[model samples]
Target: MKKTGLFFGTFNPIHIGHLIIANHMAEFSDLDHVWFVVTPKSPFKAKQTLLGDHHRYQMVLEATQEYPKLEPCDIEFKLPQPNYTIDTLTHLQERYGDSRQFALIMGEDNLNGFHKWKNYEAILEYYQLYVYPRISGQKIAEALKDHPKIHRVAAPVMEISSTFIRREHKAGKNIRPLLPESVWRYMDEMNFYR
Candidate 1:
């Protein structure tokens, strides 16, 4: 049976922080592969700032292509916009079948609002939750105390984020160190988000 880890995010521009966490999860957890589920637009966030979906998807592909364990997924692209996590999970289960087990990889910050997710309780019942440490004021055990299928990962907390990189780039500053050299070159060649 193949164990798959689904890491969901807008990935406005895939950066080092996202890759580090995915790699960390694959290295430390029982997950055989980590898929970057590049969401078109998160319903929980403001939409005005989001880049084109294909652009974000390509960025993920470019950043993760070197790593065999990392895969960029566009599952949400075929689905409706403002895609729900539970819906994607359901689709994956039906498409991938029972021989494969799928787990949801998320930051502790999102756990606090987990209740607001569509069919949130059902998600807990159906899939395991892999939690990683986020900025602050979030703990895996405390936030997901009610959910039995929860796994608190001990991966390093990456403070870098695409938001920070985008801000720096927009400000005419350097973001070379914040992302992979290949990704930086791709963004530079295309003059993305400038």
Candidate 2:
């Protein structure tokens, strides 16, 4: 069976940090492929500040072009809005469970609030979670230290954030260093986040 890691995010603009983590998970973890699941709107995030779903999806596609194992998925686009991770996973299992084993890839910060997620316990029961380190995650890391389903990955922790990029771009600063060249050019051409 193909072991796939589902890295779900709004990816307002796909950045090098996102690529690095996804690539690291694909290489270092037991995952055979890492799918960048672009959600149209996340229940936990404000939708007004997000780039259009299609735009974010395209940016992910462009940014991940060089990585064979990294795929940009639009499955959530066809599903309901204010998407919940569990629903997406359930759909994926129904569609690909026969040939693929899906794992959830998330930041340790998300794990901090994992209990508040919709059907959180069901998620733990059904899928393995690969958590990467994040700044200010130590407290939650300690809290979840005994959770057998969550695996802490030794991926490099970069402080890069899409919110920071958006803020800098809106402030008329160059954000090239923080993003993939193609995604940066596309955002520039479209005058996004300005």
Candidate 3:
């Protein structure tokens, strides 16, 4: 089975930080490919500058075009709103079958609250989780901190966030450096966050 990493996010605007993490997983980790699963909606977040689903997916496609191991996935777009990880994983298994082994790529901060996710226990029981370091004040959950299925990857700590970029651009600040050149130019041409 080919090992794959599923990096889920709304990707309101895919940035360089997102690219670094995904590419690192594809090249440095056990994953053969890293798929950026563009989420339609996040149950945890309020949609502030949430662009259309297709637009965000398009941005991901443009940003990842150069990377052969990185792919943009819109799996959750066809699923119901308020999509959950467990459900998506189940769906992916059904669609891709046993030929692919899928894992979740997450930030260290999210590990702190992983237990709160719906069917999180089932998720851990069934799939591996590739955790990347993040600059967070929270501690990882005791149960998850030492789970056998969790693999902590020593990827770069990316402090950049889409929210910050959007806020700065809206304030007339140049936030182009924080994004991939293709993504930055696309956002600029679209007049997004302005």
Candidate 4:
């Protein structure tokens, strides 16, 4: 069977922190490729301030181009907006046939609200979940203990966020250090989020 991990994120703009997490997952997990599922819109988040989906997707492309392990995926964009993970998983499974197995990669912070996801139980039943520490490893493990397919990993946490970077950009501050050099250059060249 082919092993693949889907690192789903809004990726408002792919940054170094996101890259680090993806790299860690690639190194530690049995994933052949880590696909960055660039979400068009997240149902849980406030959408007024969100960047355009295509711009964010392009930034992800630039950021992950050098890393063979990372592939920027727009499958979610093709799916329904405010899309449910379970529905996306179902679609992907059918599209790939029975030969491939995909694991959902997430952070511990997502654990609290995971139950709120549509058809959450079915998602756990079919796809294996690889969770990175967002709060604490023990908490993650405890919360996901009921799911046999869930694996909590101790990925290095980089205290960086796209929100912080966006704030800096709006304030006319340098955001180069917060993002991958390629993303920074692309953002600058395109004059985005200013």
lDDT values for all models: 0.88, 0.92, 0.93, 0.84
Per-residue lDDT of model 1, residues 1-194, tens digit only: 98989999989888899999999988889998899999988898888888888888888999999988899999999998789998999899899976889999998888888888999989998899898888887554464776568888988898998888888898999889988887898889889777
Candidate 2 residue lDDT tens string, 1-194 = 99999999999888999999999999999999999999888888888998888899999999999999999999999997778888899999999999999999999888878889999989999899999999882477465777899999999998999999999989988889999899988998999999
C-alpha lDDT of candidate 4 relative to the true structure: 0.84
Quote the positional error of residue 66 for candidate 3 in Å. 0.2
Deviating ranges (above 4 Å) for candidate 1:
138-143
Error of 1 at 1 (Å): 1.1
* Residue-pair clashes, model 1: 0
Best by TM-score: 3
> Looking at model 3, which ten-residue stretch has the lowest summed lDDT?
40-49
Tell me the number of clashing residue pairs for each predicted model: 0, 0, 0, 0
Error of 2 at 162 (Å): 0.4
Give the lDDT of residue 117 in candidate 3: 95
Residue clash pairs of candidate 3: none
> TM-scores for all candidates?
0.94, 0.96, 0.98, 0.92
